[model samples]
Target: MKKYVEIAIVLIAWFALILQLIILKDSLANYFSYFTILSNLLVAISLTPKLLASATSFGKRFSLPKTKSAIALYIFIVGLVYNLVLRGIWEPKGWQLVADNLLHVVVPLAYFSYWVVFVNKISLVWKDMISWTYFPLVYLAYSLIRGYFVNWYPYPFLDVNKFGYQQVLINTFFVVLAFISIGLAMIYYNKLMTRNR
Candidate 1:
């Protein structure tokens, strides 16, 4: 049953992503620049092995509790930040609406549900929250550098041209802080679940 749900999530994520890519076919680089796309891609890629239950080294590594938890954290952030900051900025229509909701809403909720129910929580630790910071920080650096050359940003919070560097830095700081805070909360929830179990 868990495998089935994981497979469903992987399919939904890919479908949404493909739909998005087709919509943005002319500006593929801009399409990939969004953290939402990258995070959903990670969810689809990381969980894909669950369908096969493979014994390969890559499968085993991705199957680890840490890897699962990190992907969950990222996808959760995608949903969180999107709903809170970007949801109302523009209205999507037609196939774009389907792609938007699936990528931003369905995939995040489904993946997080899978994590809470199936991923092992006993092995998670407080320091894992700190380790989770690496991906977002690296992504932030990448976005800023890429935005420098491309003259566009995926989200307004990270848009230096609009907000200027200082404001963008402050925004980045808060965004990273949100990521860490949510990570700590996830660790707490994991420990709490473990204790109650």
Candidate 2:
């Protein structure tokens, strides 16, 4: 049941993302403009192995790094932050509205559920949480560099051009704090879950 649910969510995420691409057309020339897409795509694709594991021996062997769990947590944060901070700004309509909710709301819930209910337990540590920062750090550098070149920023908080480096950096600091907090919770939650089991 969980496997089927994951497969369905992954399909919905990908299909909606593709539809968004068609709708936005030229606007998404730089696909990385939205972290929602990057995180959702990564988490959805990463989940394919687990979703397929019930059927294929190859999927069974598709062992992934435990650190991928951090990506799952991060993607959940993406959805959380978007709905909390950015959703009202978009005011989407029709299919845009549908796609927005699926990508930024439904997909995250689905992936997090898969993680909690289906994924095998892996030992987690503070070091694993530290490793999670690397991806977000690299993404920040990439977004800043790309923004400098293209004069576009993905999120208002990170728009160095408008907010300038200092303000953007401050915003980034808070975001990093949020990431670390959630990462710690994830590590501890995994430990507790294992203990209870």
Best-performing candidate as measured by lDDT: 1
Task: TM-score each candidate.
Answer: 0.96, 0.88
- Tell me how candidate 1 scores on lDDT: 0.89
lDDT of 1 by residue, 1-197 (tens): 98789889989998999988888744877887788999999998887775665587777888989889999999999999999999999999999899999999999999999999989878988988877899899999999999899898889899998999999999999999899888889999988987887
Clashes of each: 0, 0
State the local distance difference test value for candidate 2: 0.77
Residue 112 of model 1 has an lDDT of 94
CA deviation > 4 Å runs, candidate 1: none
TM-score: which candidate is best? 1
Cα-based lDDT at residue 5, candidate 1 = 90
For candidate 1, which ten residues in a row score worst on lDDT?
Answer: 47-56
Q: What value does the lDDT take at residue 74 in candidate 1?
A: 95
The digit string of per-residue lDDT tens for model 2 on 1-197 reads 86677678779878878877777744665765678888877776666766666356644443354645776777888887897888777688888888888888888887777777766646666788777888787887888888899898888888887888999999989888888898888888888988887
